[model samples]
Target: MSERVTPGHSGGLITLGTADALWAGLTNGSAVPTVSAACTCFPADVRAGYVLLGGRVVATVKAGGGQWGVPEMEVRRAAAELNVVKMDHGDLVRIGPFGGAPKQKQNDTAPLRWRQRIARELQELGDVERAAPSEGRLHHLAGIDWRVLVEETRDRTVRAWWLPRAVVRLLDAAEHAETRWLQAARTRQNSTAAAEPPSQRRQIRAAGGRQTTSPHSPTTAPRPYNGELKELLYSALSRKHGISRKVAEWMCAVCRTTPATVLDHCHEHGYVRAPVCQSCNTQERPDHLYSNDIRVASHYTRLFDTHNVDWLRHWHRCPGCRTRTTLPLPHLAAWTAYIACRSLRPTHRAPRGRKPCGVLRVSWTGSQNAPRSCLLTVTVDFCPSGEHRVLAQIPYREAAERFGTWLAETAPAVAAAAGPDRLDGLPTQPRPVIPDTNSDGQALF
Candidate 1:
């Protein structure tokens, strides 16, 4: 046969009912008495009060009105016996008429015991500092004292999750020291840079100080006979003579020479021997003046010698006529012709003959053999040969009148051939006209 268990009964003992029912029965005086039939004899259907015995309940005899009750002395005795049984079994039990049971008292200290067990296990595993409360023990230890756990135990197996104030203070001190060291290093670098010598500093300046200095000017000395000396000489010459300095000097030097002797030498040597003081003549070779005509002729010869035949071809061609046969005279001869032409009257005509003076002669004739109203004469000679003669005879006024007529007739054609004049805005002058009259009394228009 199997043993049967009932409510509020376990391990062959009767246990107390719920706290609410037990308190109601005790206060209302309706307690029921439960007793083991094998142990003690009691009246049938007897009701009694119950009292606490450790974590269990026990029945007592009822008083009036069928109310269960317990005597103070019996209650004390049962309490002492239950205390002993509780210490022996680490719990309490109860016996009733229906069954023997265990106590239903809650074990309030169970969680703290489990917590201690877990902490020991973590320490053995070298992880106590990292251990957290288990789900089963969280509510149990929610209000427990932690002072003893914190003070007595040292968890060298795990690192602390939070930093201590002393370690933080040390870290702050190291950081400050590093910052100060860096500042000192920078200060030293600046001081060394500033201590450089001035010359070295200049070398390090931007672009080596090229911007600060100006370039040096070239060191050339001036030659003599500058503008000032030229102006002074010009003033002196102008004051002393009415001529330019160049002409005056030339005329003075020529005047010193014997004209007759100079003229003779000019024909033979093509130059006039320069006159000199007696002292200079004895000391130096004589200098001479080359004739302008010979100089001009020689210049052309040199030009022809140096240049090709094309240059000479260009020189002979008349730009206006576009004819190579019409040639210009040498520059010196042209200038002499121009001067002679300018000096004579336009009416005068050159004559042709040799006179008694051995020079060529020229005269101009009027309408008849009239004397003052008729003729004018010119004599031509060479300086060295002393040849003087009449060269030509013609009517002076008649020649001029004829030339004017020729000019009028040719001017338009010459002007058109020469293109526009650059300076005078006029055209080139024309060749003069010659007039011829016969025995008939008609004038040649």
Candidate 2:
């Protein structure tokens, strides 16, 4: 008959060990006996090992055996069902799901092996909790599904199970080996990203293009980097009136709700005009390559012809804002209607540290500590035919009374339509803060 095998007893395998010294020691039973600490046999130089149960050696780890870690969750449930303390020896069994039963199992007098403990735990927890309960990466690495058969070799030996320091050393080595590669991959990705042009596209591709980082002052602190990116962004195109995409993006051509995403370019010169949002890029810009500006002056060549009394017969709309007044004069006329309502204002000044906004998000109440005020500015953009003259900015409120008096005398009907205290014309020459009355407070009229 074939030799009868004992649970965890490997007298036969001991003679066949690859190492001569280890084999000799096992053959003579001179091998230092040790214990299994789940993933590995601990206390080095030990050839024969015992798998313990409640302080007793129920089976040998054998001359040749597999190893694994006891998952934390399994240990807890098994201890609870087996009536063993969860923290004590609960994580001991780290050996694997062996292919088959041990030739014989040595059951401890306490009557609980890993299988009995886990089985009782599973039964008590019921199907829902027992099947594929929540587990982590470490649990997958250490715990195996198979259990060792324990009844074949029953014993009264008792020993507590704890992972020796040797096992911890082995785990640390494995972790260090894997982490090196993960860290290297992250560094390489950052290098590749730094090569691209700076764009404020920090949000994930799937996150609807929302910004990833915190926002700061649009002028002093631009988004995605800073004003430093402005020059480089349009260096290839044009730099005459270069404005950073960050500041320009805050305003759109059509509406302030959406941000400008593209640089508005001059079609004829292939130069950067201004930063414009995506909506204006597609909708606001004219289709034709030439005269593509949205301004009404470009489309209505008749207005540029000599200004005549008849020109006032047809009411015109302001090209910039489409604001029409009852003056019945050409919108491009030298005079502007004096309205009593609030006018467009600027919050730009040198001492205050705020520059003029190329594109503005007008509603935000800016820094409380800084000097802030909005003044109405009017431009009398009168250019001779065939000549393009940049209109000078004249303080509208400062000259309101003088301009209004001139309009009242020159165009009484236009002044009446403009409401009271309205300016229907500008003086041949400009002056700042010319009140309706002289220093004596008498009516200048």
Q: Could you tell me which 10 consecutive residues in candidate 2 have the lowest summed lDDT?
A: 213-222
Please provide, for model 1 over 283-397, each residue's C-alpha lDDT reduced to its tens digit, 9 standing for 90 to 100: 1111111111111112232233332132222222223211212112222122222222324312222356422232222333332213246543444544235545443343434
Give residue 152's lDDT in candidate 1 (0 to 100).
22
Estimate the TM-score of every prediction.
0.13, 0.16
Candidate 2 positional error at 34, Å: 68
TM-score of 1: 0.13
User: What 10-residue stretch in candidate 1 is worst by lDDT?
Assistant: 258-267
| Cα lDDT, model 2, residue 63 | 27
- Going through the candidates in the order shown, the clash numbers are 40, 13
Model 2 per-residue lDDT tens digits across residues 1-445: 2222234643323221222222222223211121122222211111222112121121122223543112222222322322321222221222212223243333222222333333333334444223453332111111111222111111263211122222222222222222222233334435545865557323212122211111110111112312222213234644545344243424333223333455543221222334433333333211111110112222122222332221222221111111122221112122321222114323345577954322211111111112143122232222223333322233333234444565455545644545433233322222111122111211110
lDDT of the structure predicted as candidate 2: 0.26
* Candidate 2 segments whose C-alpha is farther than 4 A from its true place: 1-249, 266-273, 287-445
